[model samples]
Target: MLSIRAVICTLTCLLFSGLALAQATPRAPGLTFLYSLNCTLGASLPVGAGPNGNRVVIPITGGSFKGPRLSGKVLPLGADWGLIDSKNTFSADTRYQLQTDDNAHIFISTSGPAQSDGFIHLRIKFETGSSKYYWLNNVIAVGILTSGNGYVAIDAWQLTSPTKA
Candidate 1:
């Protein structure tokens, strides 16, 4: 049998722990509109089935992007090495370059799985040394990709703190 003092202490600890957990609960992050990319593509070249999945390489011919912060054109040198696994999920893996209208070069990579809504959800990343657009290097971004007859469109947003104004 526990002592009354021990019982009271345990109850107090449990109550404070519950209160701590309530205060620690995390809120969902918010998103800020980042950019939109519309890219033309060449034909996809099938790479046959590999150990992980069926692979294809789709060339990114050319395109453009616009946003409140920056606008640019997609260079012609990029490709998407996408894969389809046994579960029939398409995983897009792409690396590309963007040339801003002002001539700063930015490199971008996006990877994510296709969802049930027929949209490919993307994790977008960026790299550049230009002082004007260097903020892209630190953002956590997401995108929704839609494919058309000969091109692909991506609408991207940056993750933000819920309290961000």
Candidate 2:
């Protein structure tokens, strides 16, 4: 009976251990951790919602139009990217990339004592895939105190990973 109880306990611990490990490290399959950024950033987007609506939106803020214009630095604490701007640009350069079929899962975490050099922006492009049921998962968090108080900025582009079957 004692041996039986010991075996049961060992099996239970092993099963639960796997679950805990999975929770700690979730991954989105088929995509590689492309690249990331910190501190300051930049870009430009063209838009056309209407004559009075969003005609053109571009990320032309970070630095020089032809140079590395973004400034600032942040530690990986928490808080994802905020929707500073959006345009009809056909580029996924501003965000992370995951290349799963249509049902790929994505997880993002943003933690930080945030800060900005009074600069932030985003642009949207065509979500292209062969699958018609493509889904998008977006999560943005802002842990920034840009006015009186101070905060650190962790540009999200720094943390990217991939998962494969």
**TM-score winner among the candidates?**
1
CA lDDT, every prediction? 0.95, 0.32
**Per-residue lDDT tens digits of candidate 1, residues 1-165?**
999999999999999999998895577799999889999999999998999899999999999999999998999998999999999999999999999999999999999999999999999999999999999999999999999998999999999987733
| Superposition TM-score, candidate 1 onto the true structure | 0.91
Question: For model 2, how does the per-residue alpha-carbon lDDT over 1-165 read when each residue is reduced to its tens digit?
Answer: 579889999999999998888785556533222223323323324444544334322221221111132222222222223322244222112232222333432222332221244533332222324333133233122222122122222223212346454
Global CA lDDT computed for model 2: 0.32
All candidates: TM-score: 0.91, 0.19
lDDT of residue 17 for candidate 1: 95
Cα TM-score of candidate 2: 0.19
Which ranges of candidate 2 are over 4 A from the true structure? 1-36, 39-43, 49-52, 55-95, 98-117, 121-140, 143-165
lDDT of 2 at 91: 18
In candidate 1, how many Å is residue 78 off?
0.9
Candidate 2: residue 106 lDDT (0-100):
29
